[model samples]
Target chain A: MESIRLFCPATVANISCGFDVLGLCLDTIGDEMTITKTAQKGIQITRITGADLPLDVTQNVAGIAAQAFLEQLGTDQGFAIEIHKKIKAGSGIGSSAASAAGAVFGLNALCGNPFTNKELISFAMKGEALASGCEHADNVAPALLGGFTLIRGYEPLDVIALPVPSELYVTVIHPQIALKTAEMRAVLAPEIPLKNAIAQWGNLGGFIAGLYTEDYNLMQRSLSDKIVEPVRSPFIPGFDKIKETALQNGALGAGISGSGPSIFTLNKGIKTAKKVAFAIAENYTETGIPFEVYTSPINKSGVRIINR
Target chain B: MESIRLFCPATVANISCGFDVLGLCLDTIGDEMTITKTAQKGIQITRITGADLPLDVTQNVAGIAAQAFLEQLGTDQGFAIEIHKKIKAGSGIGSSAASAAGAVFGLNALCGNPFTNKELISFAMKGEALASGCEHADNVAPALLGGFTLIRGYEPLDVIALPVPSELYVTVIHPQIALKTAEMRAVLAPEIPLKNAIAQWGNLGGFIAGLYTEDYNLMQRSLSDKIVEPVRSPFIPGFDKIKETALQNGALGAGISGSGPSIFTLNKGIKTAKKVAFAIAENYTETGIPFEVYTSPINKSGVRIINR
Candidate 1:
């Protein structure tokens, strides 16, 4: 194929309790990138839209990922990419991952799909390293593989696609404020109490089981995070109240999405999800800062080729 | 029913990396307790065997567990328990759990199983607390429910039975050295580095997912304790050599079973399990501390009544 257009869905990383290891893909919002083969001997960003992301291939996440993918294939075949990003950068809903994973996913398709999904993830991780100071795939893995993902280890790139309950829907609220990932990480304590870590280990084990067994009560019980939420929630305005309201309105669990400035709650049904959305939105009433509430069923399919 | 005989199999608490949260039952090694009803109305120990254990109803694990069970039933009827225990105390093979869980299992059956499995676990935990000075169900959960189990939380009693791969075999070497669980627990650092905790959390989340998804490689990769094994292994003679030899001989993963003096290795099949057993046994030749190797399939059926 001379050209390919891919839709890489937005994702929520950390899922409230699992810091740096857990993430889930979303269906309603994402980024679209189109890569076309050109006579030029290097990757180039032809156009960038919907967000003021860098146009330079070296600075752009999509470009950096595409560059890595093409270089890994040892190809001098030049490509031009046009990015129409629906998911804003610095939104904390894996914005950079959508761009990075999309670039790799799109370019690999244009280059005859040479790399495995695991290899593609490696290419995208480089982009994340460029965007953030650290190379992480909590967002990138789920963005590339879809549904719920566990980045078991970053050293050898162990990405696991966990089972997703069919009845679950994701309710997300992205506040207007921009919170950098690095800044969000800086707010965390250098070490946590042993008791808190033990609690997290238990919740992580139970939550994964709940997904496989489809036990809602177990899932709900497991959603309360002991380590990260209490520390990071204060950074996001009205985070505590919003999460409290969402759960009170029937959310399975609620927490700050990714780095924050965005909040997400999981619900069992659409009716409950809608109610959660309204309740979460009502929390930002005094700030006068605009926020968008999105309701999506767990995106069963992650990134996809839309046009060729 | 006036009398009931039950077998509560030995279990591996922590199951490699998940301290205080994960455990598994074994088919070959455990404890057997027999309970008989008496009109005199109090719990009593009629006989004990396999290891010297206290006979006082309040002092013995089996007896303490039985007292709790009988008291919960509001029964004036007394019971006599014969502890033909196979799992050794201070062996780190859930010896206490077997004694405790066995007592309750026999009594519950004698009383028509008034409590659900969850309730039985709560009652059994009391026995473990009395024996070990801590209220933990990592061993008791599996000893009662069988197969692979996750103690999601000790508070409010969340015990979940996870799936076990059919081909998985457990090969355990119990060194005949007495290691007190409380002393072993005391050696652990009160707090761990956050980096280590993050790594543990990732391993734990992946380990549970691997169980539900039946991914053997993921499960194997996850079975290393970054927190407990390194700190406590020095207390167990020849621990590192046994574990190293087991892995070298084709064991998937090896670690301290619960507290130490015993080490367990998991393998994919009986053939490899046998090889691991031999390798582990050979390691103890220098120390000359007596050790026993028991190999069996994952005990899917935990505690069972042989006669009613």
Candidate 2:
């Protein structure tokens, strides 16, 4: 196929206890992108809609990701990308990741799948680094591999795709306040108490176990962040109350998604997820902050072909 | 049953990345004890054998655990516990845990099994506190519940029993050096780098996922310690060499077994486990320190009735 239309998923990172290592893809919330094979031997971002991002090949995440993929492939083949962003930038829900992952995913598909979905993560992370100021896989991984993904380490860029329970649903509330990744990171301390770290790892282990066993109660119990949430939550207005509201409305767990400003909740079923979404929206409305709520099942397929 | 004899399996706690929260039971290395119902009004230690230990109920771990269990049961009836210790105290294996878990397990069995194996963890922890100076359930949970166990948290005492792969085996080398838990803990800082904490939790999540999926290679990759091992390894002579030797000998992973002095390696099969045990023994023989090596399958049953 010379041209391919793709749907790239948004992802929620730092799921409670899984700070820099865990993430899950979202269905029904993403960006639409079209990539076409070009005779000119270079990558290009021809157009971007719904968000005012740079069009420069080096500046745009899609362009950066596409460049990374082609450079690694050592191919003279060029591609032009058009991104129709549905997930807003700086919303703390892997907005850049969708664009980055989509570029490589579509390019690999158009190139007769030169790379596996997992292989696309490193290329996507090059773009992610431009957005987050660091090459982290928490968002890009899930956005590429689908479902739950764990960034076990970075030296070798080890990423593992975890099982997704069929009934699991996610409700993300993106408060329209501008929470930059750097500003959110600045609030955190470089060191944490060993005791708190132990608790966090324990909860992380439990949460993974819960996913494998499909135990909702265990997931609820294990969904706690001892180190990051306490310090970062203060930056977001009514963060505690929003989390309490979600929990009260039947969310399995709630915590800061990626960084501050966006709060995500995981629920066992769509009914509870929608209830959590409504409750969080109604509660956060008092703050008079413009916010959009999206509820979707855990996306089983990260990036998919829309049309060709 | 008026009188019951029980065998309580030894356990390996920490398991590298799962510090303070994870453990697994062993099949062959354990302690044997007999508890008998008596007309007396409280718990008693009637006989002691195989090792020097206290006859007084309060001083003995078994007695302390029995007291906690009986007190919680609000029972006026009494029992006599005979100690036949096969597992050495201060061996870094779960010697105290075996006794404690065995006491509660045997008492619960005689008392019509009111408490589940999971419920007995708290009572067993009461005895564990006497040994570790803290109410940590890593060893006790596995000793009572068997297989692999994760102590998710302590506030409400959440203990989760994890699935054990059928081929998993453990090899433990007890270097006969006096290494105190307090000293081992002293080497560690109260705080750790947030980056290392993230790496630890990432490995922990991966390790749990590996356990559930029976992925040995994943388990091998995830069995790493970043925070505790660096500071504590120096206390154990030839730790690095021993670990390298284990890895070189095809062991899946190796680390300090609860605290120090005892080194443990996990292997995919009994053959590899025994091979690891023999290699560790030969390597440590050069240290001129007397050592004992035990290789066993992963014990699925924690404490079992040997006779009634």
Query: Which numbered prediction scores highest in lDDT against the true structure?
Result: 2
lDDT of 2 by residue, B1-308 (tens): 29999998889999999999999999998888999999988999999888898998898899999999999999998999997888888888899999999999999999999989999999999998998898889899999989999999998999998999989999999888888888888888999999999999989988998899899999999999988888888888889989998999999999989997788999999889988888888999999989899999989989999999
Q: What does candidate 2 score on TM?
A: 0.99
The C-alpha lDDT values of all candidates are 0.86, 0.92
| Alpha carbon lDDT at B219, candidate 1 | 86
Q: Which residue runs of candidate 2 sit more than 4 Å off their true CA positions?
A: none
Residue A99 CA displacement from its true place in model 1, Å? 0.7
* Chain B, candidate 1: TM-score: 0.97
Per-prediction DockQ, in order?
0.81, 0.95
lDDT of 1 by residue, B1-308 (tens): 38888878999988766888899998888777788998777988999998888888889888878888878889887889899978878888898999888888888877787997668888888899998897789888998889988888867888888999878899999889888888988898877877788788889988888877777889888886788888889888888888889989988899999888789899988999999998777777778888899998998979988787
Which ten contiguous residues of candidate 2 chain B have the minimum total lDDT? B83-92
- Please list all clashing residue pairs in model 2, or write none if there are none: none
Candidate with best TM-score = 2
User: How far is A8's C-alpha from truth in model 2 (Å)?
Assistant: 1.1
